[model samples]
Target: MKCSAPLALASATRGRPREFDPDQALAAALQVFWRRGYESASMAELTEAMGITKPSLYACFGNKEALFKKALDLYERDKLKYIGTALEAKTAHEVAERLLNCALATHCGASDPQGCLGVISMVGCTAEAESIRADVVARRASSEAAVVRRFEQAKADGDLPESVCPTKLASCLMTVLQGLSVKAQGGAKREDLQGAIDTFLTMWPRR
Candidate 1:
């Protein structure tokens, strides 16, 4: 991966006093949401974790929902690179393996929080946060749809068997991935997730 510099904030960001590194603040906010879910994480918690006041948080990232959305964007961009790369694989099976293995490592990695922000953002969430939940659901669906499209292309290229259903396979793989995210959040070891990934790969359609 290429190294890039952190984003610099403009002067008097949105006409409010800027107090901290925007990237760092956003990252802190992401972790708060990741660890506490959407509604459970209050402005006090967000500001404390972000090392910014409420005014600064509003100026930098708008309201709570907007901040959560921005955090989700950062989470996906930084953590979900594998999904895009997996689509470029030579076969549908390779695509699934790449996605599953990457997901396992990401969810279980020591560097970041356990589980997935996408999964954590929605569990036991309230109706007040329905839009955020919907947003997370839509993003997950889009990912699964991308997998389905990749599998469709693989089938067209004869990488997959003619009798197999691309959509069904993609949904199955996505289901496993979602389950793995929950397990990882529950403190499942990396090796355990890897074992699950290995088992899932064995079920992948063969030529």
Candidate 2:
């Protein structure tokens, strides 16, 4: 839960110039919402956190909800970009491994110790988190579908045993990855998450 300090709030006033720094304000707002859910985050707290006045906060990001959404979007764009690249892997196995491994690696702080913004920061925010959750759900579905497609190809190519079920295997793998995300957020180590993945991979159909 070690968070960076909030940045300053800057918004263009009267179209003259950005009176304050928008990035810092948005980042400060992000910390506010990240620590406290959108419903729980207060205007007083956000203004204090952003080092700005009430009207200025509203002027920059509209309302609290818009500000929260903007912060969430920034998080998704910056931290969740790993997912986009992983989806382009040659096989579903590769895709799933790359997706979860990269996530766990970064999330566990092998690179940075902040756990994960996607899974960790949004834990209790079902209402305000719908869009972000939908993003995760959609990504999981698309990734699993890709896995299923690759499994089908593998079966056709005689890489998997005839008993393999693409749909079932994909579902199982997705479940494993979901578990990994939660575990990583809960302070699981890279080796621990990798072990879980290895166990799941062993469940794959063998020729």
**Candidate with best TM-score:** 1
- The most accurate candidate by lDDT is 1
Question: Compared with the true structure, what per-residue lDDT tens digits does model 1 show for residues 1-207?
Answer: 111232454553344444578889999998888888888899999999988899877766778998899899999999998899989999888998899888877877755437788888877466688999899999999999999999999999999998999999899989898899889888777778888889879988799
lDDT of each residue in 96-117, candidate 2, tens digit only? 6777777666566434233454
Clashing pairs in 1: none
Off by over 4 Å in 2: 1-16, 31-45, 110-123, 126-165
Residue 22 lDDT, candidate 2, scale 0-100: 71
TM-score to true structure, per model: 0.89, 0.66
Scored against the true structure, residue 179 in model 2 reaches a CA lDDT of 72
